[model samples]
Target: MSNVTTYKVTGMSCGHCEGAVSSELSEIEGVSAVQAAADTGLVTVTFTEEPDDEAVRAAVDEAGYELVGRA
Candidate 1:
């Protein structure tokens, strides 16, 4: 089964920021899909398995954004 999670991110101000975050998250081993919205500062990730939330947060942090919360 697929495991999907949505995170509320902050400090994304442009499409470049979204693209960076998307690229980072997409490179993760189990990540199947990633959608990052600059306008809403939301990131939705779909994984082949239950991916580590910390990894996701780390990816965002590496991309120069902040993961505020998850749902």
Candidate 2:
């Protein structure tokens, strides 16, 4: 089954930032799609499996952004 998750991210100031976040999230094992918006500070991810929040956080952190929260 697939699930969609929205994560609140901080410190995204431009399109490049959004791209970076999106790229990182896309690399996750079960992630199917990633849409990141710098203006909204949100990253919406679709996954084929339930992904651990920590995994999401780590990917964002490695991309030089902060995962502030999720919905």
Candidate 3:
């Protein structure tokens, strides 16, 4: 089965920001997909299992954004 989670993120301003967030999340081991919206500041992640929150936070941080927890 697949589990999809949406996180509230901040500091996204354009397509580049979306790509940055998406790229970081996509590199995670279990993440199957990533969709980051610069307008809404939402990052949707799909995976086979529940991914660690710390890992998610780190990815967002690395992308120069803030992970504001589940949405």
Query: What would the TM-scores of all predictions be?
Result: 0.91, 0.94, 0.96
Clashing pairs in 1: none
Best model number under TM-score:
3
Return the top candidate by lDDT.
3
After superposition of all CA atoms, the RMSD between model 3 and the true structure is 0.6
Residue 20 lDDT in candidate 2 = 94
lDDT of 1 by residue, 1-71 (tens): 78788999999999899999999999899899999999988899999976688888899999999989795
Q: RMSD of each candidate?
A: 1.1, 0.9, 0.6
Can you give the lDDT of residue 22 in candidate 2?
90
**Candidate 1: misplaced stretches above 4 Å?**
none
Off by over 4 Å in 3: none
Candidates' C-alpha lDDT: 0.90, 0.92, 0.94
Q: Give the C-alpha lDDT of model 1.
A: 0.90
> Please, what are the lDDT tens digits per residue for candidate 3 over residues 1-71?
88999999999999999999999999888999999999999999999877899999999999899999999
- Give lDDT for model 2: 0.92
The best-first sequence of candidates by lDDT reads: 3, 2, 1
